[model samples]
Target: MSLDVDIGHASGRGPRDLNEDFAGAVRAQPGDRRQGLIAAVADGVSGGGLGLEAAQTTVMGLLSDYFATPPGWEPTVALDRLIRAQNAWLADHNRRRRGEGAALTTLTALALQGQTWTLAHVGDTRAWLLRQGEQGPELSLLTQDHALDHPDQRSRLTRAVGLDDGLRVDFAQGEAQVGDTLVLTSDGVHGVLRPTRLAELAAWGTADLAARALVQAALEAGGQDNASALVLRVQGLDPRQLHDEQAWGRTLPVPSPLRVGEALDGLTVTARVADTGVHLLYQVRAADGALGALKTLHPSRASDPQERDMLAHEAWLGRRLTEAEVPGVVRVWPRPAHASAFYLLFDWHQGRTLEQLMAGPGGPPRVADALTAALAWTRTLARLHRLGMVHRDLKPGNLHLGDDGQWRLLDLGVALSGQENAEQRALHAGTPSYMNPEQWEEGGQADAGSDLFALGVTLYQWLTGRLPFGELEPYPRGRHRREPVPASRLRPDVPIWLDRVLAKALAPQARQRFETAEELLLALERGASRPLQPARALPLLQRDPRAALQLALGLSLALNAVLLLWLALWR
Candidate 1:
């Protein structure tokens, strides 16, 4: 059900006057599966009088800061950021006290999350993996020492924390399985004990007993240095999270198109919904007669790896949002154990999209209702932006109004959560009509500003049933020199204050627009009592480059013609 592990650590002074080795392990809070487990070992360089301080700080800093990073960040990204920051701080401290010995240490850290293990290492500190194989228990070294190859200089570290301004950390990742054992040690333990002897001790018993035995054996083997050992045995692995989506999509088979009355994985298809060329949607009924929405790739694009990855990412985002209890989003169901095909199952809500409501026989909702909905939606966007997520596609069609009177944001296939590969970010996503002007330019990428722009466009359409920029195609278009006709102009009932807010939201230049969702929300909350000041006008050139260019050409042409006429008269 969740990541399960047994961990223990031990350190002894051995023949040293003071123990300079530090080791620590921190497990994620119960039910916090995403944070996973972090364990580290640091061996303080003996020459440095502050060796104990360096070892303790490096190990403790990593244990605390790694969890503080954004949950959406990849393990490698988070570790690199924290390690680099710690290294910089320690290096600066050493520079300030130049005469004093530098606080230098060797660090080797490991993170076990879901079904994978990630390692970050430097100096001669080591990590090892012991696994039960068909042949027997095997021990494999997981990290290389950042030291010299020559026998004489083997103990001299080439890379270490606080050694210099620059730090080079080696990183490695591999699949983790139940019954696997991980071990971390300071050079004092591994330098004196042979691999075979270490492996025998590591396989002895409980993690705590095994770790103590390792330190004892190293000291008895005539090791004169401080000895430390940290051990962890995997008891179980958590369900694969977002990082594993690409691998899952690659291995799983894409199901053939299903028809009404057909059942796959206990869900019977009741009706085909929409086929958007890249994907297919279906209305299905569970065994208990509950309705659900199923989404899968269209048969034509079944072989496209990018499409599969995109779908998996969408599913992962949906699940993560739901688990976080993020409001205004649909909940995604876990994949069934007997799944014959790769598809996403979401809780079905009976609702009409904002687009449908705008086009219905009754026409768009009242101005007050639309404004209220916009306020609620903006709050949702604020939460998403705070989490470093951007809903690439935010339009009326993706905004749902449930029969239960709640609003939901849908279709996260193109959203960016920072884990997206460059290829995914470059894809031209979202409706052309709702997309901002910058997104139409070359090399443009979507961000929170883009989502806010789309929201403004959606609200504009909801109120007036018209696009502010007329019908914008995917290619180059006429420059928009003038501002959007105020919403009040299209609908007399729309208030001036609401129009002002929308104008700020729809500013063509990102600098002139509301940089955050919270700012837009505050404006809406103020309403007529505190109307926002009008935005400053842009220079003529920036207002409309096309128009400026045209005017220059026309003036030049007329001046040439006048000169020619004068010359002819003079002749």
Candidate 2:
């Protein structure tokens, strides 16, 4: 599929003696559909002697190297690797000229792959998304400010390329619609313009006019530094490109079961690890004797388009996720021209599942271990949420504690991406015990909030060795509501703050839960000192009529006794 875009950029020295801001956009060769488009903006640290050079080199290097990356590499991975190399080069160049200040700059890059947008950010420069809303076009900030929070030091960036020997960059990707507009700006521009005003400027005339107007707006608002703006208006996206792979997957027929000694596609099946009715998993050895996991749909689901599509979607997401804690796909075997079933191979992780580890000889994890796991999973979930995907089935069983002491989230069979259709939402996927209340209702869709609720349940179980809401009934029938008991009640070692956090996460109403995984993670890190407010609950009278009636009768009797005493005293 083709993605047509209208691009524009403008930069001005403003009040600065020399402009240190740079921006550029590059389109892939006309025949190279896979490389897609790249746009970047960089702002040099003004005090650095080589500020201008740093900004120019960063933007130019990124635009050039990103397109030169191998076609097979994902946009985020490619961009990150290129940026790191550029950072090292800049650092080396600065070291040679130690007499002068080191070259340092903030970089933000966006890559449009089909209808997906991948972002790499490492400084105060900002990226924003403007989408058509019911009221009007809405503006949403897409990058963190990456600067010190104190008022006097707010302009000082905490992270930037060439500033340090090693760099930690923020990477995110999400689906983009045809009408969406991606905007990138140096702090000189955004620092002076409010988000509302930026939205207005973004909508003016064409992309070129919009970019020029934004820079002018900044200059008019007392710009004190170099100002720059880059605007990309998504003119069109081909829907078929997004789903063609899935359509091909639906045509593959399920293969028959394999025996331990049988070989399929150069891999010898060694053992069957799991048979979950819907799918089958096998431990296999490649011809070279390397170990791997083979996953394929069950014969029963061979003709089912929905099942096939889910499998394809899972494979697609697995390939895109770059987090170490996310299980990586080793290779996806093509459906041979003659073969019926399709299978996916994954790097075999030789570690116990989190479920097994917790239930193993060690018993429930210590508070420290539980907290660590919670934080790790929270970060992983946050990444997934930012990518506009929800891991509907998040539980101990789907998590693997690698022998290397790393925990990786596994399985995406029921995961939902931003592009899912209504039919997929009504499919009733996910474990009921870990699902939020909304997931039980007809046509209820799971979002980041639902994922947080599942995380709370998972953490509760990990800490207390008990389910917060007890056993769950099957879907369409599991509508019962019950208050979650405090984890401290079962495990005295569980802290009150931790329990409160879980309680809020398990709140029956979606609105009562943490808005995002990042918030939940922050709360966990802060510990009991910052206690979460207890979730609102129904009054005792509404909760239990019998207890309310008993209390009312007791109060009435006491009132009658008091009246009689008063009357006798008066006589």
Best by TM-score: 1
Residue runs of model 2 more than 4 Å from their true location after superposition:
1-242, 322-341, 475-482, 534-571
Per-residue C-alpha lDDT of model 1 across residues 1-571, encoded as one tens digit per residue: 7788899888989988899999999988765535589999999985645988889999999998887777766677778888888899999998998687788899999988777788999899999999998889999999998899999998788999988888888988876889999999998899999999999999989999999999999999999999999999999888777756654565577878899999999999999999988899999999999899999999899899789879988988888888888899888887786577889999899989988888889986798898889988998899889877999999988999999998999999999988776678889988888888888778988999999999998999888989888877786475445689999988999988988898998876888899899999999999999999888878768988878998999999999999999999999
The C-alpha lDDT values of all candidates are: 0.87, 0.81
**Worst lDDT 10-window in candidate 2:** 327-336
In order of appearance, the predictions have TM-scores of 0.65, 0.52
True-vs-predicted CA distance for residue 413, candidate 2, Å: 0.3
Q: What clash pairs does model 1 have?
A: none
lDDT of 2: 0.81
Q: How many clashes does the backbone of model 2 have?
A: 1
Assess candidate 1 and give its TM-score to the true structure: 0.65
Residue 26, candidate 1: alpha-carbon lDDT: 93
